[model samples]
Target: MNSLDTTRIRSYFDFPAAGRVVTNNAASTQPPRELIGLLQRCAPWYENVHRGQSTASRRTTAMYEASFDTIAAWLNAPGRGCIATYRNTTEAINAVMYSLLTDFRDGDNVVTTMLEHNSNYVPWHALCREILPRLGRRVELRLARFDATGRLDLDHLASLVDKRTKLVCCTGASNFFGTKPDLSKIRAIADAGGYPQPTGERRALLLVDAAQLAPTSALDVQALDVDYLAFSFHKMLAPFGVGVLYAKRHLLDHALPFLYGGDMIADGGVTTETVAWNDLPWKYTAGTPNILGVIASAQALRLLLDMVMPTAFFGGSGPLPRVAIEEVMARVGRHTANLTARCMAGLSEIKNLRVYGPEHRTPLVSFTIDGISPFAIAEALDRRGIEARAGCHCATLAHRALGLDPPATCRLSFALYNTPDDVDLATDAVRETVAGRRRAGRPRPGRAQVSTAAGRPT
Candidate 1:
């Protein structure tokens, strides 16, 4: 497989200059200097969209609205009407829940999986357990289990879906296990449920949390046939605070607005009798939106193509071709997979280290040492200038299901800009930390006292 030019890609970001190994990409990626520069270039045109008649308003509104088109083209959506912006993935999923709040029937259930992040799971959990119950609805929240290898148990997931299932929420990829579930299969399972919806469809809606999947994979929303898909741009080299929720155009038209205010209403169409909502995409975008963030985030997608391919596609405004997107992301997947393989191979040489998930995974690895706390291992790696994450990573259900008390693991994730040398440096740091602990006679503690420094049990 061909690899990305890591040297050239690294030069686009300022992090590498500080000698930082940014392995926590699953949480968020380092923003390119060009995206920062793009933010500055957009400063002079700053104005609220759909609010005023000034030139700045017209210019900024055009760019902001065009951003929706760019994002829609990135995901191969029908149009910008199907797209909605949010603070992050968590808020995007929450918007879905709120929009469909009154749609759930008394006996309907929502099927989810242990492989989902908390962003995907918690909202449904709250919907069924907390919110719906008070409204005299006994909606069920069913959870599918994962297999020993951390893969989503397809059979278990199939059993959880039935005619009464209203929605099936699953992660496109596990941030902890690094496992990318077969979304097509999940979509089929959701379809087989045959639940009648207000839109006259007879299939359960499928919502995919693509926070991890979108960064390294070519995700075509129409090809996947997902009812809704959400992801954060920060996970794909954009500045924090911009995420996308792509739904079917019809779904957006029928579903109620999550947040109702300001520009969401029709232009001077509000009155004491009734307030007509605005057009598609705009109705979902309530209030003064993040004008600069949306433009920068959309440009970040363009910059990502340039960073991966040996070409210049940034600083332009137009539709990104599906062929170019597929080729660039395929190269990114291959490079990160290679790095992950090397890192896992090197970690296997360490005695008593237990890595989670399958041998082939997305671009990250989470593992635990038999005698060492994950926090201590993370701290030691930090001392060696290796940045790693130690926590449940919002995969709390998966960690708890695996019987990990306090529910945490140390993770080292990679991005397109990370090189093989970065993987070697990380694994070597792990080896030295383990060996040093052994030489220091640090005995393994009992379960009762084997707590994380944050006081969570391990």
Candidate 2:
């Protein structure tokens, strides 16, 4: 059963009235109506932040700046200096790649897992396979494997890290497999790899793509001891635009700016001979940011707390107590976990289907029927008013590594708002879809085929 009053939480969204069951939450969670209202609430005073002299600018700037604190507090980071916003998690991770580009020595390597979403894997791939090589650096990229049960092979991960390993990029939760690695254990392995940093630290830096974890769990960056962590606001009930990257304060202080332009420079500190960079975060924020989006994303977190709990503990702007965050997110984690368990149980009952990942997953299920096309399953589910996602879910590397011919699967990922009823509807759709395909023995044009079979699949 869900830990929160899901019926009441459903009231905060518009999907219920519209009869839309959004089970594809790993791609993006539905934004609450209140987040839209929050954006409307900021419409009047919305102005360029840090660049204007007007009162509206200062007011909007305060809200924008305060957004970072909310994000930092949500992750239990040291302070706002560690936070940097981007267009999405993909961009946020790419920023890390660029900022650390020059630091990679010729003989260095990066250790990442095959279970990573492309957002985490592709950036490192390009850094090692494409970009760094073009610059005359032959930095190697090593992939740690996941077992058939979808858990990261910690032993395999350990074997890949050594003194030459510079960074270890991992996914906190797998979008396709729904596996969650032991982050603390991963940290221990990363630290065991004694790479000499320019900062004199003898360890491989750790970067976690928290895209799946952040939406449901309360995370403590200090506790994880990760050097870099990235996640998208869209996965957590905010609008589609903003993503975040959290680094240690010293790292941000030392790394080069990802994108350099107008606002990132210190005021009048730019001379023709010497250009000064702006302080902590704005040094990373190059131009006019998604000011309204940042404010709304922060407000989304506040609204989330009020939705899950009995009281309004967070507001528009104030210090967000870590205790409050831990409480609210624990409820969210429990609710989603129950929904995922229900999904897994329902999917298990569907005949001739293979569900990926371990029993304890991060609120998602990806599976394939023996003879049905995954895309067709998604299409059939959509026709039933049950939203589902098909394709690799950008976990192309994992899908390919698993020996999937076309490298895809139909995925049903849950959130705090998902209900037991939603899981039934999704699995029922899949069961019926597979049954329908079986009845029609021959391949039809423009439809799913049991490509390996001449007739109906048993």
Candidate 3:
């Protein structure tokens, strides 16, 4: 049980107007002081790394490689596993897709779920579109459906896997509902020789996209039996432009590199005609890497593991355990049977509102006020100094699937920093917005009238 100091946590971020009433731990997060200082120190040294003959370039390259070691430690990956520093999760996913396609044949299938962010979806879909035709093969996209509560239907996943299945990819925690998938169970099902299905296939490799889960909890790869895992630094409290991909050693050696360029070779020296390739990390890094961001990421991770343990690290109950970190999260989960309960509890008082996503959810929720466009809702909140996001959230498929009209949903995500007071402010702002619109007597098309004070629509 770690004792969390809310006051100390409060001092770290730059809150918005209205004394920072609007807060979110989604999209990205505020890094520590040391991360800022580290970036500031390296700002000027942003010259091309590994290309120069100078001592400074050599030192920078060393720092860059050292960052991989730090990332490996944080991820608890095998020492032999190759760590490729990427621009972001998108690039890493692309690399993985391409590399997997190099070895996997047309008959081989890779399984993913509906829960994936676009970052994980697009690359593979692109491969399926472009490569499947060439090889005369078919790629199957399988989703493990969830119940009304957003818990993954493991039984559904078990039904999908067969001998041809080569890779199984899934998100550790859902960004939409904050639902945590049971990876251990997934791994076991995949690896079990006697697969439930009629096919006599053994286990498939497991790839976890831990982008959302890593920030809130410690991810022990060995414990989870994950073969490959990828995540970004910016989401975890560092700046953007840097990401990490942990691929088991055998996979690294067998997989092909996505981008081809200078550093990724053993020797690209031109003797009128000569070219060779470099090893693991270098092979995948095609251009001048984001040295400063990589350094900052390494430093930021160290800071989180060291200084910010209370809120980000420790989890339990009571004074000894820290309420804001663990206990509150538990209460939030318990307070509502699902996302619908939790969000409705907060927004039921607000007139003309509709919540989106499964009733069972994570700390994040998206909703829309009746007859209000998402953009208008966001602007209204901004006027009241309530910070929120309005857009597709890079999930066009999900929006289309949900049959959303008028516009995209307005998103408000919670983190350890968010208090119950924050929820109250957000709910009140929605109520005020709806009431103010009604007072203006503007007819909201396809929208129903309701009493705000009564909480739910009469």
> Candidate 2 has what TM-score?
0.95
Candidate 1 displacement at residue 367 in angstroms: 0.3
RMSD of each: 4.6, 3.3, 6.9
Q: How accurate is candidate 1 locally (lDDT)?
A: 0.92
Stretches of candidate 3 off by over 4 Å are 1-3, 14-22, 43-48, 192-202, 267-276, 309-345, 348-361, 442-458
Lowest lDDT block of 10, candidate 3? 314-323
Mind giving the per-residue lDDT tens digits that candidate 2 earns over 234-269? 999998999999999989989999898889999998
- lDDT of each prediction vs. the true structure? 0.92, 0.90, 0.67
- Judge candidate 3 against the unseen true structure and give its global Cα lDDT, from 0 to 1: 0.67
Reference-based TM-score, model 1: 0.96
- List where candidate 1 sits over 4 angstroms from the true fold: 442-458
Distance from true location, Cα of 267 in model 1, Å? 0.8
TM-score of each: 0.96, 0.95, 0.80
Give a tens-digit lDDT track for model 1, residues 1-458: 36788888898999987989888899999999998988888788777888889999999889888899889999999899999999999999999999999999999999999988999999999999999999999999999999999999999999999999999999999999999899989999999999999999999999999999999998899999999999999998999999999999999999999999999998888899999999989999888888788888998888898877765668777778899989999999999999999999999999999999999999999999987999999999999999999999999999999999769999999999999899999999999999999988654565343445768644
lDDT score of residue 152 within candidate 3: 66
Query: Which candidate ranks first by lDDT, i.e. highest?
Result: 1
